[model samples]
Target: MRTSLACGALMGMWLGTALAEDDVESVRARSNPAQGYCERVRGTSRAEAALEWAPEVFASVGAVNAGVAIGGNDDTPLGSPKMRVTAGLGYDFVGIYRGRTLRSRAEAECRRYQALAALQGALARGSRLGETEALQARARALAEALPQAETLVSSLREELRDGSATLEELNAVQVRLDQLRSLARDTEQARARLGLEPAVAEGQDLGALLTAFESADDQVEALAGGLRRARAWRVSLRGGYDEVFDEILDVDQDTPLFGQLTVGYNIGHLWQGKANAQAREGRRQETRDAVDSAPRQVRQLLGELRLTEQGEQQRLREVSTLVSDLEGQLREVEQLETRQVRRFRDYLLLELARLKAEQAYLGAHLKTLQSLLGGVKS
Candidate 1:
């Protein structure tokens, strides 16, 4: 018998573990949709594709040109046509820099999209989890209050029959009971609709989150700087070779190789570049200012939440005190039938008030949890 019991217990534990694992998997599937689908719909894929093609685009910066010519001399119209082939190779020094700048910009854009997607998913999951927890808290509070409400209503009914309590009093107590039941049912249904369990709250470092955002923005600024530099004066060098073959003369000739050097400047850009550069510089400074102030902004937000939480806590304490006083008064007046019924009704109302206070406190806590979740790495 002992052996059988031990084996059965082990089997139960194993089954429980497997079920728990399955639940976790189900939750993950519900929370995180396919990344590919999100990327396609959100335009992340477009940026990624651009980044992927950057190398091919960069290769075009170094250009190659080729041509062929075929002609016959007037003196030998019927002879085999003379043929010439020419090719030139050139590299634009400024174009290379511009290509690199463009590739960097593409990379930055891709990262921005990826970050946005992750943040969106995290916020969505956090909202669902926070809401589920809030509803669960409210339901628990109502459950605790329901039995007291029912007892108070029953006592008031008995008093009404004895002519010690008025019908209006009984009706009022009955209504409170009904309201509690209705609220409980509604909270449960809302919780069920979420289909999510409360997640264990995890602490996230604010500094680290800020750093991630700053790094992404810095990449964009660096790319912008590179582009500005790439727009400066440019120089290109090209060389070409030509060869001719004539069947009528039964001879081959090689033309002298030619080389060319060019300097380029955009006259229109010369007047506009300075203003644009200044504008970019101003924007970069703004970004820097924002980064510098981010920590303070985050701290201020957290401070406000803390203040709200403290206020909720104080309210909960006051409600608890009222509940205690009502309970004491009820015990003292138990011998007085009508008075006992009234005190019990008062106790029930106080209980409901306490529950409401508790719910408010939980709501404040949920908001804090959501804020922290927002900063968490997805």
Candidate 2:
């Protein structure tokens, strides 16, 4: 029988998780109209466009040279009165390096925007509408019980004046009633900001919710891309065809086309590149370390949240048991006025306790959900 009960409980939990998944999907579908608004507001669309066109933009950064030179002896020179026209093209490697860096930075921004969008979507779907409704109901119950509590306090004060009740008893009842009044007001205000929107059902599987938040290594990618660009800036290549036309030379003697290739390294930029590469490599290593440690950090956070949830659940159970006991006691002494008064007071206080316990448990549950869904922020 114990094994059967355990299996039944597990099956119920599984069903609850399945239902929660469906609820999440429903909420996501409902919120789809507002999706990507965050990215658009943040101007990531332009950054995305920049990333797409980065290669062509950088490839176009080059120099084209065209010149006319005339130099020859006017008298009996081999190519007197010679006029030469030259055209060539050259590129600077620094421009390519800068373009690559800009592209990497744009990619990093895009990744950050994606991460924020995911977080916002999770929050939108995980609305606290149900929790707010529950609080509103609690507020209504508190409101209805306030008059009864005031009547009880008045009777207690009269009893204290006639020496039928102690001052301590009167004060305790007054304090409890005051607490209930305050709690009622606070609960009423809790519903003030709630919107009428469907939300994912409570008791979602943490692992499943966590699947929505994947760790992003945008910083590492940017740094590594920078390092690559820095290392690549050491070498420069200039290859082009120069065309020259000489008026003084015959067609066979004229060098109409000359092909030249120049491969060179900037020793100055080599030193600069070494320094830049070292700095970028160091930064990349630091980012890599952080990314590697993120999983452990997330695990620690989730573990703490789970423990808090368990604690709140335990408290809710204890408060529920107390409320149940008080109800039974109140019913047992229905005909005894004095006993009923005392039992009723205890019941009212225990009812408040139960509500608070429920609130705390729900709060813990929400915290756990947010932590699991947000993961490590980018």
Candidate 3:
């Protein structure tokens, strides 16, 4: 009786799931760019995964075939016969079989690495979007602060002419106000970089760049491991059993079992192994060269992040000083005369500047995190 119904049902379910995925693959691809790219990458890996087990399956069948043997001799007396059975297994430790086994293992490892890269790529897109939102918020707040900063600078100049503020103080305040306007303009440019419109590509963001680096690195490692396996010595082991009987000889044969171990070297494989090692080493060196260049690229990006952080800090300090000066002057004016409306406007201007500084700081902070994490994609 066959007892494979449960196994067959499970296999059917797995096949059904695979067919369902194919039907939905197109729809999912169209839903989002990241998902589409990830699906394509995984599809390629699935093909690799499918073939990776073929060598193992073939080897298993070969092992079973080696276990049974039978033979009978009829050249004896008419009523007598001789029978014999021998069983043994043979393993080719060197050559095609070993190479195929190694290749299969390498392919399996590469498939797993590729899958991880695809998943990370999808997550990276979300991280890029988060960076865009933070920068956009900073740009909007800075745009509102620009006019207020201009007004404050003009008021400082007027105070300088009235002998209430020194010439040096007026110049310093003017510089700070000009710097604020420049930062606002810079923020707008950063916003444009984050936009989806047709603009000059600034290459990939830090996340995507890092993702590419990691993927390449994984490839190099997989190839290096395969090269090592190709160069190493291999050993194979096997065992089997057989039984035979001959009634004509009035004798019954007993069952026998045997095992074998083989260790071999292939002269032709030596050159092939050397060639594979050289190829893998060449690729690994190439990837290492690229990795070496990454530090310079990352340093430049980190410098930009640092500059933005410093800008936010300076702007916050300048705004705080301006607010204190405005409050002190307004307090004296309120006691000597009534200029409540002007005082209120100056207070609002200072408050607005503070808020812009805070938003810009937050944006800069997000940018710093993005640079530091610097994963591929996001």
Candidate 4:
């Protein structure tokens, strides 16, 4: 069985380099692309699942014969009796069977690895979309939002001029308008992080740059997720072969003229088709559970993104108010209003708001990665 298994390992198979870094045999071809690996795994699974055969071979070079004699003539003597003799040689065959149940199963394991690679790749890509790439997308949205904000701010300002808008209306609009400004700045920071110049330097708006930076971060998280999945699938692949063994061997009969006989089966199975099937099921269940989690993860990411946007708007309001509230005014009878004091206070407040927006973007990016990775794991 050991020898047979060793021989079987040499069977032709394709491999992919995707798993090379991990130093594992995950599929037929090491260089296989994601879809290709998945297809191979499926094929292997089907072939193994349908396995059911045991070819029997036998051969012999022995012969058998018998002879009889005729009755004697009446004249010669009634006492004379007929004579007969028989002698022969022959060989029988014990079954020599070859089973595909386990071999097909081994192949199936390879296929499973292929599947894992594909899932891993997808997860990685999706995660990438969430961060650096995703951030880039958000940047675009920020750019669009900036114009809308500017228009709203201008319109509100005009309304305030007319007596149509009350103090409350003006205050509300002012708050929203300020929020827009802060978000615009955040967007700029995002872009700079990406190594891309902001779209517009002069009043370029805040969040545009940040959006680009966020996009890159999206990529980082996505790649990380995919790698995680790929690693996990590798373990499952090995599990498939943990208990495979063979139960057949060739031997020579001890007796003499039995004519060079040569076959029989010992019947042993360490890692066989049954084990393979179980492993497959295990992986399948694992993936199914992952799939179940995907939608929820994605929804959560979306929610986070929305919240981050809202947060940015909120921060903008705080910033605008901060600036507008103390519009370079010295208090009457101000004895000691050091520049350092005012600068320090304003810096702290701005820094806090800036950090929040950055953190929101980071959170959204992380969620995107989780959702993407979750998909692959499934």
Which scores higher on lDDT, 1 or 3?
1
Among these predicted structures, which one has the highest TM-score?
1
Give the alpha-carbon lDDT of every model.
0.55, 0.50, 0.50, 0.38
Tens digits of per-residue lDDT for model 3, 181-259: 5665565555544443221112235445445554655564555556455446556666675543455344443546656
For model 2, residues 1-378, the per-residue Cα lDDT tens digits are: 433453354355446544655665666676754245544533654564344333321112232222333565454334333344444444445555555555555555455444444434334543341354355446545545565566667776677789878777766666776676567546544543333333334344433333332323435354555545454443334433444344334334344444444455534554665766566667545543565443334444456555554665676577667667766665765646784376455545545554554555455545544545343332
Clashes of each: 0, 0, 5, 62
- Please report, as a residue range, the 10-residue window in candidate 2 with the lowest summed lDDT: 56-65
- Model 2 RMSD to the real structure? 13.1
What residue runs in model 1 are displaced by over 4 Å at the alpha carbon? 1-82, 86-107, 110-136, 147-169, 178-215, 227-243, 248-281, 284-310, 320-346, 349-360, 363-378
Model 4 per-residue lDDT tens digits across residues 220-327: 333333323322221110011111111222222243222233333333333344654555456444433555543334434334545554554566566556544443
RMSD (Å) of each candidate, 1 decimal: 11.3, 13.1, 17.5, 23.3
TM-score of 4: 0.27
Candidate of highest lDDT: 1
Clashing pairs in 1: none
Under the 3 Å rule for N, CA and C atoms, how many clashes does model 3 have?
A: 5
Ranking by lDDT: 1, 3, 2, 4
User: How do all the candidates rank in terms of TM-score, highest first?
Assistant: 1, 2, 3, 4
How many Å off is the CA of 20 in candidate 3?
Answer: 31
- Model 4 worst lDDT run, 10 consecutive residues: 235-244
